[model samples]
Target: MESRDYMNLSTDKAFPKLLNPGESLLMSLKVIKFNKRNKAQERTIALTSTSLLNLKGKKLQRRMDITSLGGITRSKHGDEFVLHSPSEYDYRFGSPLKDQAIQTLCQAFKNLTGRTLYVWESNEISLKDLTTTKSDKKKGLNKMPAPETAINFRGEVPNFNEESKDSRGKRSRTIFAATENPSAALLDDFTILKVLGRGSFGKVMLVRRKDNGQLYAMKSLRKDALLESDQVEHTKTEKLILQHINHPFLVKLEYAFATSTKIYFVMEFMKGGELFYHLREAKRFPEDRARFYAAQVGLGLGHLHEQNIVYRDLKPENVLMDEFGNVYLSDFGMAKMLGENGSTQTFVGTPEYVAPEIISCAGHNITADWWSFGVLIYEMIVGIPPFYDQNVNLMYELIQRGKLKFPVKSPVSDNAKDIITKLLDRDPTRRLGAQGFNEIKNHPFFAPIDWVALEAKRLPTPFTPRITDPLQAENFDREFTDEAPTDSVIPENKLNMILQNQEQFQAFH
Candidate 1:
């Protein structure tokens, strides 16, 4: 039997005791009860851990009751609110709801022999019998504040079959806030097939337009996530860039929609997956193969810079290609629009691919993207990043010093190394800027590259898929491997929720 199968059959009940020294399980706590006026009755109180588990999938909320309460209350008289509860009394909590029955009794004793209350014991075991204290409770006033969540409705409102329009009705001009874009609606002709990716913000899906049966990629981000990350401006900036810019090498935005819960972007789907996964699988590409991809990316970056937009994140994962071998730059989630002088201050980028200036939290321009391009080209020729370390701190220090080394045994040409050296120059001013790509294109490194022909998607790809089936498990490689297999925790429910929610999201507009 497989290891996973064995695990499924095992019922040792020892998993909960597997914590190592100094390791502890942390669970986010939410209030299960509220006091009068719908406020948190008490800031801190002890409750059984099992009680929290009962509220597993429920959102935290408050309720109010006008009845009497024994706990000390905080009112306008804050100075005299503090008081000690009765020393020899038993406190209790009662609930009238069927599923919400709660009873917590606390008996305060002044000392060992101060007082005693007689009560007959029932033969049944109590919760206190099962509770075990490994150590004394840590002395501290623990404060837990509930997180604010912005709702992104996941269902659509029902529509009526009857048309409400009259034959001679007058139409009035309606303007949406800021831009005159239309509200979001479901494209009845398209079907969402599978989830492409998911993150804290939202998710991406593989969709097929029923009109032409053409596959397209759709990315959806919840407005709450944007608001929480304080990246609302960043998302808006990407929308603006997508609106004003038009380039073949860049991922084209087909359409966009905004709902109360999320914003969706429909774009051309790249079936070839991430460039990173391809490079990892092939080990390393030949110099010509590397140059072909690099040149296409550089051209795209150059076009973006010309339009005054900076692609802050330029790692291989953000670069994509279609099944036909046409490459395009994607992931504008971290992109930024340049100021009047074409400048930006935000420090953002993937660590291995980030420019040194960005690491130091200093300002940089389109030149930063070129530097990252240099690192990418180097990585393409070699299987590993130029400066990688097991320790991330050491890696950051090495990057700050701008140190990149190449193996002598590697068959990469000298011209490729020269371009890398120029691009990796620590000084941003002399760091082979946007025009450096032109210099590289004319170099002997790309002697066989017919730039004009390649841009038109006519050039043949050096590496063709030995396996033609798109859904083949082996064809997915590192990119889709995790999603290809299903055992436990396969994210099937999340995907279903997203699909069902998409319908609701379409109507939420």
Candidate 2:
């Protein structure tokens, strides 16, 4: 297709509105609907100003709100497309004019939502990309080239053990009996001090416990938003993991309680702030400093693995530092407990650090975390992810290719490069730490690290944050700390919504 084909395609002058009042038909094309259980049926897909309508002859089969769409994914060949919805099943469609269809949808979506409709390389879209807006255009959203890379196939590994037990040898529960009343008293234990960070689900705040007068980082999540995004189970998993795991390099959960409209997690406040902030300020860390941080994180991952849990999301942002500069792995929302000798097929993780197995839709285990570890090591020393590209699709292609290259100016040590290359191996079975994290700890790069001392956090850190006050969050982003620290008032009408779904979060305490 020519570039001009996508121009002026957002107007309804060329197509009439269909199915809805005041909705203009942006594009109409014949597509083959691929169903796993049923045969591929021919259908007409109409992209309107407000919704995407799938029609079989004169009957409408499905109508998806354009605003509800998470993103779009195109097959390596321009013959198939997948419409991703945040709250619904992905709709797969095949068409000879797939390129035209994608362009039309992107243009129309951008025009209607005032946001760029990202064309993901795979169906596993990152939550970060799903919530991105046009303000991220400079980061190169919606700028992928036509599909040309060959798709690699891997057999799906089935996990026979469906559920895993906790340290007490009891099956984990998603919803438990309420241990505390859902009232204002739930939050009265902690005095809100400062806003630490904010996200789609809720915000993290610095708080002081009224009973002990100890400071903590309280993460508050909205119940309605959790139900809307279908993340109730993941939230429960995070709570379960936090309650069981204890390590010097892992953030500890001090308390967990929920109100009628929100769930709260009180954790040890890492005064040194996110490693991302420090890394950005320093531009890049020296090999010695990077090794110091990597060793702690490796131990944290090792502990989680020993408990049969996988820390799938490991990045600089998720790694926080204490006042003494010791790093701790935070955020267990993406972490999961796998059964013995079992793997999961869930596609979740930051795109830059995602493993090749995850991108291929093959089952993945703890080894996936090793791949992210390698990416983090490379990024720490080189100042950017090795496979990073402005275009996300091209980045994924580079990741699958598994080519290792060092920057010409960055003087990475031979040992560092060796460990990174071994971890970035395309085959998960051959990847470093596949057998165990002992292999990683014994690597020549980490030879200087004293495992015993590091695990106990007795080793001196390379950097220590200058914290002037225990209550001040000078190391955190000012954008968040400057905001009001009060919890949002729930509307009287929304109280009914919270009551209706109270059972879903009964065990949250």
Candidate 3:
């Protein structure tokens, strides 16, 4: 492994062993780390790689500096550039080095490494031209190559025009969510800090961007599994929903991209863990504390409804908090976007939170969120859903019966009971927020809430999780932490089928 600064590259310096283009070399970079004040600098870069891809049979150690595969490509932010190939676009250099500048670096490579005629080595001509140049005798232009030592690659010349362009181009990106300051943050932009959680299909990983050291949650889903399980549409739905919605109380999709095998969604890291984890430990929350949490969720849901989005899944597990106790709604696998007066008859949602309309296979709209809100509040107050039962059918019956039964032991307030009652109404038309969130926001239960300040995150939370570090996983379930991450075993036949039908999952990127 070599540790060298790109700025200090000189042909006279002895370079590391030169290998074939595709051969995995243990690449490292030299960088200067400094505090926010730009003081106390350290000239070093981490010996880490963000890519999970194995080059052939060997591991490829990638870095953001020194040298990158993707050539310097223009960015939407004018001269701002991202360098890397389109296929294995591993590293995106956020800034520095341009066309002619790249030629200068290649000169350094030639001087240090001792090679002649580097293939696709010039910025003025396409890489293909390097291998075979057309002869034009009329113009008296001679086919001349750079003399002596050169670098060459087995693969075709990288499309410099589209090098920075990801699978999701600017137009495709607009199909999902719009961002004021869109994330140029690719999946490879962040190094995997830890495996946060994993399921049958994919994983939620803790990642830190090399450029800014900011932490985020990266959810990598297997495209093959999504296709095999017939969940391609669900995956697309989640991405589209996330792109359209953004709020402080809602988890934001910072960036999204996909590879041949996996799809990734980069999101804000909620360090406080799932609300269910805390609820299970405490048994239940007091009215005031529950009210505070519920209000935060309501604001999030209300905003979604305002955008004509219905959060079909609203449970404690999806509610996450930051170190400051600011709660956000995460996981939009079941959320759907409907136009004004638009509705869907999708029988989706967790059994407990599923509205009667959804279970009945009748068309449902934004009103469905109100019912989930009722179940969530009930669980917060009583530590158990109102219709808790060992039998699934019995639970469904309880929900359909529309019976408002409260535990005798619970000293529920009139305002609390009043809001829950209206929300859990069997008739979707009569439910709180049916007309809009205005009906629910005006309820006495949330009278203390200042809509503006709440949105501004001015209200003090009742509880802040004991999260001193973003990497701390104490609040999370040990089962997930302790379990070894199992690899996805996709049958070759299934993978081929998914590729043939790749158009179905196009929205995922």
**Best candidate according to TM-score:** 2
lDDT of 1 by residue, 1-509 (tens): 01111111123344233333532222221121222221212121122222111122232222111011122211111111111122211121111110111211111111112222111111211111111121111332211111121011121211213222221111111100000133233545467766665544565676777767877777777654444334556666677677667777898877777644567777877777667667767778888788888878877888887777788788776788777666789868677778887666665666567788875657888888878888889888986667664333344557877457887888677888888888888778888874645765676666778889877778887765444655432333334345633212313323543454344343224
Error of 1 at 260 (Å): 2.1
- Candidates, ranked, TM-score: 2, 3, 1
Candidate 3, residue 280: lDDT: 82
Model 3 compared with the native: what TM-score?
A: 0.62
TM-score of each: 0.59, 0.69, 0.62
Evaluated at residue 350, the lDDT of candidate 2 is: 69
What is the TM-score of candidate 1? 0.59
lDDT of 2 by residue, 1-509 (tens): 12222212345443343456787666665565756432345676777767887877556777888877656666542345677664655676755456656666666666677766656554321122223233334454542223232121121211113222111121111111001322333588889999988755678999998977989998998886576445788888898898888888999887788877998988889999988878877878999999999999998999999999988888887899999999999989888889866799876776678899986668999999999999999988887778875333455567888468897787889999999999999899999999999999899999999989888778899999989996879988887899989987765755776788789997875
Better of 1 and 2 by lDDT: 2
Residue 86 local lDDT, model 1? 26
RMSD of each: 19.3, 14.7, 22.9
lDDT for each candidate structure: 0.52, 0.73, 0.61
For 179-209, candidate 3 gives per-residue lDDT tens digits of 1224565655778766766543577877788
Residue 404, candidate 1: alpha-carbon lDDT: 74
Q: Order of candidates by lDDT, top first?
A: 2, 3, 1
For candidate 2, list the clashing residue pairs, or say none.
Answer: none
lDDT (Cα, 0-100) at 186 in candidate 1? 52
